[model samples]
Target chain A: MTDELDRDLLLEFAKAEQPLKSKEFTTNVMRETQILGNRKKRSLWLYGLVLLALCILFAGPLVKLGTMFAIGFISPLVSFENPWLATLTMPVNNIASIVVAMLIGGRFIWKKASQ
Target chain B: MNNYQETSEAGIINLARTGDPRAFEELVHRRQSIIRNLMRRLCNDVTLAEDLAQQVFLKVWQSIAQLSRVNAFDGWLKRIAINTWLQYLRKNDAMRNSLEFNDTVYVPPPGSNGSVAMDLDKALLVLPEQVRTCVVLAYHEGMSHPEISEAIELPLGTVKSHINRGAKKVTEMLAAYKQPTAGEKV
Candidate 1:
């Protein structure tokens, strides 16, 4: 009986242990965790945006070169059908247009990179 | 208690990992009371206990994702709490100085009823930090000897020895208070 009583008393004392009451404890912890979570999300989005920008920056030259090759290959067919037209306008106009588009794209990329 | 079970500590941990701040807060609310009590017993200073409690929760928040195997949540939190307390003891020069000075001659004032509860708190304070941690984790936190050993990173034999020695010392202290000294007249 004595042993049982001692055991009971010990258990009761253990059960009574409690944490302190901080008025803003929960609020403070939640706010901090939320901020951390948001920061993680923002960093992931930033990474995605950087990858997209790189794709646009490098794909521009490749696409322009491909377009120039396609025009050159089709030039013979067009000249065979209309000799006067081919003689009047050299393919330099196509190359110039490509160069101008590239210049504009490059200016935009440089502006973004500076920012 | 399906809702309670569904919101069980494991559930709360999962939710907290998925960015549910409310779930993390719920976990804190559920465990804070016991944690505060443990801190109070360990530090024997309410203000310090409160501070340590906050630090414990902050750590729990920061490391929630690293907690795998949800069943061990309580044990994991207890380990964090113990480590946080130990770190605080190590870093705070003033507390370290006080602890060293007080260790030899610390005694509770007379006249209060020698309640088992009060005696237990005082007894816990008199123990060395590692022994006190083992005792508190074993008795107060309902952890087994193995659990206490794991939480405090001590050997199993050391944990057992601390519990035995701590309980014996507390028992002796309480017995001394119960028996009157010869010089005093009732």
Candidate 2:
């Protein structure tokens, strides 16, 4: 019976609470939401720019990777071998070779003019 | 109620699910006090309660898009509130003080001071956190043991034990306040 009374007392006390009044409560929460939303958008844009920059910076290695995979489909035996020596012997064998040669030629010409 | 105020919570939640800030603001305006009060009861500190309440709403905003049951927002919000408190406990002290309940030591919480909120805070802060949460949700929020279990992700048996012992401890602590004053009762 005592336990019952105590439980009832607690319930009544809690239920009788008037709502906490604060003029700025909702405003503060909304301000935070807006701030977080803007941060999320900003970070998304930053991530996109970073990803694009990374792709550009490593375009040469990426193209070579794509070429190696493409060769696996065209001639299935390339996947089975480790033939790094073939690239030295046959430097202009594919599209990957042409891009690398063009890049190297452009850099040499640019550096020579700057000198 | 004005026509705008009469907008059903379901309608507001549906609009919020589409990432509309106005609808979300309507949600905050409507439920902030209830959430804040619940946090205050759970945490026993006014500032922490308000901050946690804001965090709960922010989480709701972030993930409400994925909330499949629009009508179950109350339970969803309660779940988030419970999670926020539990996470705070995890980071701050890992709830290591849970085992330190001194049953024999009694510190009288003075008179009721005409503020049951203050007394409730004192009464609750006496118990360890797990017990305090169960007792608060069970008695204060009127949630069932199973509901408390699901919200706190504890087993049903553990929830029942906490509420049982926690309620007993809280009642024992507050018995002084419950006593009638001189000339108040025969």
lDDT of each residue in B1-186, candidate 1, tens digit only: 235335766677888766466677778777887778888877777788878888898888888788877888887888888888878866763222422222444465444576655666775667766666656666666678876677656688877887777666656555554555565565
lDDT of 2 by residue, B1-186 (tens): 254357898988998899988788888888887888888888888899999998998999999999998879988898888789888987887455554455544465444355767666677777777777777777766677777788777798988787777767767767765666666654
lDDT value for candidate 2?
0.76
Note the residue pairs that clash in candidate 2: none
Candidate 1, position A106, lDDT: 100
RMSD to the true structure for each prediction, in A, is 12.9, 12.1
Q: Report the error of model 1 at residue A84, Å.
A: 45
Candidate 2: regions farther than 4 A off: A1-10, A13-16, A76-115, B1-4, B100-113, B147-158, B180-186
TM-score of chain A of 2: 0.52
